[model samples]
Target chain A: MHFNNEELGQLEDRYRAKLINSLSGFKSANLIGTTDGKGNHNLAIVSSVFHIGANPPLVGMIMRPHTVTRDTLENILELGEYTINQVNADIWKQSHQTSARYEQLVSEFTEAGLTPEWLDGVKAPFVAESRLKYSLLLRESQTLEINGTVLVIGEINNVLVEDDVIANDGYIDIEALETVAVSGLDSYHVTNRLGRLSYAKPDKKPDVID
Target chain B: MHFNNEELGQLEDRYRAKLINSLSGFKSANLIGTTDGKGNHNLAIVSSVFHIGANPPLVGMIMRPHTVTRDTLENILELGEYTINQVNADIWKQSHQTSARYEQLVSEFTEAGLTPEWLDGVKAPFVAESRLKYSLLLRESQTLEINGTVLVIGEINNVLVEDDVIANDGYIDIEALETVAVSGLDSYHVTNRLGRLSYAKPDKKPDVID
Candidate 1:
C-alpha cells in the first residue's frame, strides 16, 4: 500500500495520527519522572527518548505542543532535572497508566500504585520498580517552528542499575533487564536478543556474538 | 549501583559510550536512503529516528558530530529528500553492515546486499526487502550547539507498507512486519507484542485490547 501526502492528509485525524505514530516502528519505552518545587511528582510514559551523544551523556525527547498539559516538561524546565526509567514487562501496565491525564495535584506514581524513590539528594523521584534508571539535568531545549513540538535535551547526571545488567564493554543488556519497547501510544512489547554483531568494517565480514 | 556525574565522566571512553548508548533501551532501527544530484544512491542504518509530530507528519533523526563523513545527511541536505526503511530480522545483518565506513563511491545497498528500488518518481530509493518504508521531504534542520550533533527533521511525503500490517486504527503491527529494534550500537532485537492497552482515562481502568 502506498500513501502519498495527499492520502495521508485525507485520513481521519485520529487515523492519520496513529498511522504516522506507529509507522516509525518500535521505540524506546521509558517513564519520564519529574517533580516541581513543591515536591509534586509527575510520571509520564514516553517513547521518543533517543541518544543525542555519549560524551556528555545526552538524551533527547520530543513533546507535542499544547496537545495536553505536559507536567513532565514543565517540571523538567522548572527544576532542570528529571529521571528516565526503563519500563520493564512487570511494570508496563502501571507505566502506561501514567499517560492518563490526572489532576495537577495527583501524582501518577501514587495513582498508578508505583513507588517513587529519591536517589541521594536528587529532587526528582525515580521509579523504584525500574531496574535501570538514570537522572538527567536539563541542558538545552529547542522548539520546532514547523510544528509546535519542543525538543528537550538533557545531560546524564546520575545512573542506577543492577550490576549484572552491565556488560564489561559497558553495553547494558536491555533484554536481560526485560525492558519494554512501545509502538504508537498503547502497545507494549518484550524484546529478544537477535544477536549483537561486531563493529562493521569495509574489509571484514561482521562477526555475531553468541 | 549509583553513578554520579563525576563517576560517569571517569569511566573508560568506550565503556562509557556503550553504557550511555544502551541506557535508553530499544530504538527503532531503519535504513535511511538518499541520493545526490548525480543520482548516486546512499544507504546508512540509523537508530536515532523519532517522531517530532504527526500533523505535518514529521520525523527527526540525530547525527553525531564530525562522524566519518555522513553521506546520508549530505544527500538529504543536498537534495532535500530521503527514505526511511524499517530494518527487520531478515535484513538486520545487512542493515548492520551498512554502518561500515564505506568509501563515498561505494553504495551500501550494493555493498551490504540489499536492493534499492526507486518509487514513483521519488528521488530516493526504498529498500526492497523492507516491509515498511516512507519517503520524506526535508522540512527543517538544526544543529545542537550543546554537542555539535545535527537534528534532521523531515515531513512525510510518501509511505509504503505491507497491506495486512496496518491495523484498523492505523497502527502498524511492527512485530508482524518482523521489524527489529537496535540496542546500543551493534545489538539487534526481535520484539514480541505483550498487549495493546486502551487509552488511559482518569476514571476508567484501561483495558487490554484483543
Candidate 2:
C-alpha cells in the first residue's frame, strides 16, 4: 500500500494520527517526574527522549503545543529540574496511568499508585519502583515556531541505578532491567536482545558479541 | 549508585558516551535512504527518528554536527527529499553495516547488501527489503547552537507499507512487520507486544485491550 501526500491528507484525522505515530516504530519509554513549587509530584509517560550530546550529558524531549496545558513542561520550566525514570514491565500499568488528565492539584504519583522518592539533595522525585533513573537540571529550551512545540533539553545531574544493571563497558542492561518499549500511543512492548554487533568497519564483517 | 554531574564529567570518554546513549532506552531503528542530484543512492542506519506532530505528519531526526560530513544529511539537504525505512530482523546485520564509513561516492545500499526501489514522482529510493517505509519532503532545518547538532524536520509526503501490516484503526503493526528496535549504538532488539491500554481518562482506569 502506498499513500501519497494527497491520500495521506485525505485519511480521517484520527486514523492518520495513529498511522503516523506508529510509523517510527519502538520508542524509549520513560516516566518524566517533576514537582511543582509546593512540592506536589507529577509523572508523565514520555516517548520522545533522545540523546543530544554525551560530553554535556544532554537529553531532549519534544513537548506538545503549549495550548494543551502540560504540567510536566510547566514543572520542568519552573523548577529547572526533573527526573526521568525508565518504565519497566513491573510497573508499566502504573506508568501508563500517569498519562491521565488529572486536575492541576492532583499528583499522578499518588493517582497512579506509584511511589515517589527523592534523592537527598535533588529537588524532583524519582519513581521508587524504577530500577534505572536520573535527575536532570534544565539547561535550555527552545520553542519551535514552526509547530508551536517546545524542545526541552536537560543536563544530567545525577544518575541512580541498581548495581547489576550497569555493564563493565557502561552499557546499561536495559533488557535485563525489563524496561518496556512503546509504540503508537497506548501500546507497550517487551524487547529481547537480538544481538549487539561490534562497531562497524568498512573492510570487516561485524562480530556479534555475547 | 549515584553519579553526580562532576563525576559523570570525569568518567572515561567511551564509557560516558555509552552510558549517556543507553540512558534513553530503545530508539526507533531505520535506514535513512537518500539520492543525490546525480542519482547516486545512499543508505545509513539512524535511530534518532522521533514523532514531532501528526497534523502535518512531521517527523524530526537529529543529525550529528555537519563537521563530521554526514552523507544522508547532505543528500537530504541537496535533494530536498529522503526516505525512512524501518529496520527489521531480516536485515538487521545489513542495516548495521550501513553505519560503516564508506567513501564519499559510495552507495551504502550496495555496500550493505540492501535493495533500493523507487516510487513514482519520489526522488529518493526506499529500502526494498523493508516492510515499512516513508518518504519525506524537507520542511525545515535548524541548528542547535548549544551542541552544533542539526534537527531536520520533514513532512511525510508518502508512505509505502506491506498490505497486512496496517491495522483497521490505522496503527502500523510493527511487531508483525518484524521491525527491530535499537539500544545505544549497536544493540538490536526484537519486541513482543505486552499490551495496549485505552485512551487515558482522569477518573477511570485504562482498560487493557486484548
Candidate 3:
C-alpha cells in the first residue's frame, strides 16, 4: 500500500493514529512515575522514552498535550524528579491501567493495584513490581512548535536493577528481565535475542559478538 | 544493584554508554536513508526513532553529536527529505554496517550491499529490502542544549507497506513483517506479542482485545 501526504491526512482520526504510531516500529514500554509533591502519585505508560546521551546520562520522552499525561509533565516540572519503571509482562496490565483519566487527587498506584516504593534519596515513587527502574531529575522541557507535544529531558539520578542482569561489559540483559516493548497504542511484546553484532568497521562485515 | 549519579559518572566511557543506552529498553531499529541531492546516498542504522504525534504524522529521531551520523544529518538538512526503513532480520547485518565512517562520497548502500529504490515524488531513497518503509520531509531540527545531540523532526510524506500487514483497525502487524528491535547498541531482537489490551477506563479493568 502507498499513502501520500494528502491520502494519510484523509485517514480516519483513530485509524491514522494507530497507523502513524506503529510506523516508528517497536517502542520502549515504561511507566513514568511522579508525584504532585503533596502525596498524590501519578503513573502513566509511555513508549516515547529514548536515550539522549551517556556522559550526562540523559533520557528523553514525549508528553502529548491536553491529556492525562499533563499530570506527569506538571509533576516532573514542579518537583524536578520522576521515576521510570520498565513494564514487564508481569505488570503490563497494571501499567496500562494507569493511562485512564483519574482525578488529580486520585493515585494511579492505588487505582491500578500497584505498590509505590520509595528509594533512599528519590522523591518520586517506584513501581515495586518493576524489576528494572531508575530515578531521573528533570533537566529540560521544550514544546515543539509544529506540535503541542512537550519534550521532557531528564538526567538519570540513579539506577536500580538486579546484579544478574548486567553483563561483563555493562550491557543490561533486558531480555532476562523480560522488559516488554510496545507497538501501536496497546499491544505489548516480549523479545527474543537475535545475537549481538560487533562494532561496525569499514573493512569488514560485522561479526556476531558471542 | 544501584548506581548513583556520581558512581555512574565515574564508570568507563564505553561501559557507561552500553549501560545508559540499555536503560531505555528495547528500541525501534530503523535505517534512515538520505541523500545530498547530488546522488550521494547515505544510510545509517538508528534506534532512537520515536513517534511525536499522529495528527500531523510527525516522527522524531536523535542524531549523536560529532559522529558518523553527521552525514545523515547534513543530507537531511540540505535536502529536507529522508526515508525511514524498518530494519528486519534479513538485512540487519547490512544495516549495522552503515554505521561505519565512510568518505563523504561513499554510498553505504553500495558498501552494505543493499539496493536503494525511489518512489514517485520522493527524493530520498528507500531500502528495496525493507518491507515497511516511509518517506519523511524535514519539519524541524533543534540542537539540544543539555547535550550536543540534534533532534530531527519530520512530517510523513508517504508510506509504503504490504497490505496484508495492516489490520482492520489500522494497526500495522509489524511482527508479521519481522521488523526487529535493538537493545543497547549491538544486540538485535525479534518479538513475540503477548496480547493487545483494550483502552483503559476508570470503571473497569482492561480486557484482552483479541
- Measured by lDDT, the strongest candidate is 3
* Cα lDDT computed for each candidate against the true fold: 0.89, 0.89, 0.94
Candidate 2 chain A weakest lDDT stretch, 10 residues = A63-72
lDDT of 1: 0.89
Error of 3 at A205 (Å): 1.0
Candidate 2 ranges beyond 4 A from true positions: A66-69, B66-69
TM-score of chain B of each: 0.97, 0.97, 0.98
- Which digits, one per residue and each the tens of the lDDT, describe model 1 over residues A136-205? 9999877778887888999999999998888889998989999999988688899888899998998777
Docking class of predicted structure 3: high
How close is chain A of candidate 1 to the true chain A, as a TM-score?
A: 0.97
For candidate 1, the docking band is high
Angstrom error at residue A140, model 2: 1.5
- Show the colliding residue pairs in model 3: none
What is residue A204's positional error in candidate 2, in angstroms?
1.3
lDDT of 3 by residue, A1-210 (tens): 999999999999999999999999999999999999898889999999999999899999999868988898999999999999999989989999999999988889999999999999899999999989999999999889898899999999899999998999999999999999999998999998888999999999999995
